[model samples]
Target: MSRLRPGLARVEFYAVWNEVSELLNQGHTYRSAYEFLSEKKKITMKYDSFRRHVKAQFAKKKFMEIDSQEKSVIPADNKPKRVVPATATVQAFDSKNAVPLSDLLTEE
Candidate 1:
């Protein structure tokens, strides 16, 4: 069923989203940001809703940063590849390469 959008929905925020984020990122308090923005343009959303909506932007920005960092970290196999430095040689060792306990206990 088609329904009419709410008053807040009628407010076009995408155009000013960047400015809103910049204001918050500059360390302005939510109250100050809300007040400042509301004065510049009519904001229908209540102060509390404005605070939550703006904070959600911060959360989204944080999440995106963490997600991008995670993407750059670790290979698909889950094991990180090591760079071979000339100072030291890396070796892969397993149980098959280990000396038997009996051999260690017995002296030739």
Candidate 2:
């Protein structure tokens, strides 16, 4: 069979792709996702090749999601915007009574 792409031809590439996807779902950036896999010795492709694959996959998935959402029956104006209430507010403390930064650092 003829190869579809230069980098994703190998089965190993799919494994790496899945890992990158999972990492991204967990809030990792593309570079950090690949870096995590590299640190764990789970990826075989070089950084540039791996990065290209990630960007391509991410873009493809994003486009698919947008296409699907656009096809939904619900009108865009009817959709509810998510609103999160603030849980806590910061209170300023007196600098005179606060512990010194150097002391806190040394304690750790």
Candidate 3:
């Protein structure tokens, strides 16, 4: 059986998460900010939990913008075909009619 009084869960921190993120994004290290808040009785979660939550929030905001050249009709998970000019010719391998390397090179 648990011998603890009623308290808020970690999810409760989301209520003011944006504010916390803003504060941290303003050149404040997690350790210093967390320690200050912890000492001031403003934060209840442990340092590890605080850091994890902060990192998760930050990771969510990161993303890459795909250019028109890289974009395709295919699904985002699937790699798109390489883009080339219309004048470009696609070549195929011909093992039976291979060119000899000696014929292409001659001492001038």
The candidate 3 region of ten consecutive residues with least summed lDDT is 1-10
lDDT of 1 by residue, 33-100 (tens): 77887788646456766777776777988999999999889577887679976876678778888998
Q: Name the best candidate (by TM-score).
A: 1
Of candidates 2 and 1, the better by lDDT: 2
Over all chains combined, what TM-score does candidate 2 have?
0.49
Give lDDT: candidate 1, residue 58. Answer: 73
Candidate number of the best lDDT: 2
Candidate 3 steric clashes: 0
lDDT assessment of candidate 2: 0.74
Candidate 2: tens digits of C-alpha lDDT, residues 3-108: 3455453454577677777788999887897778868977656767777776777788899999998779577679678999988988889898989999999995
Which pairs clash in model 1? none
| Runs off by more than 4 Å, candidate 3 | 1-9, 63-108
- Rank candidates by lDDT, best first: 2, 1, 3
TM-score of decoy 3: 0.46
- 25-67: candidate 3 lDDT, tens digit per residue: 7977888778766677676776777788777766765522344
CA lDDT, every prediction? 0.71, 0.74, 0.66
* Candidate 1: regions farther than 4 A off: 1-11, 76-108
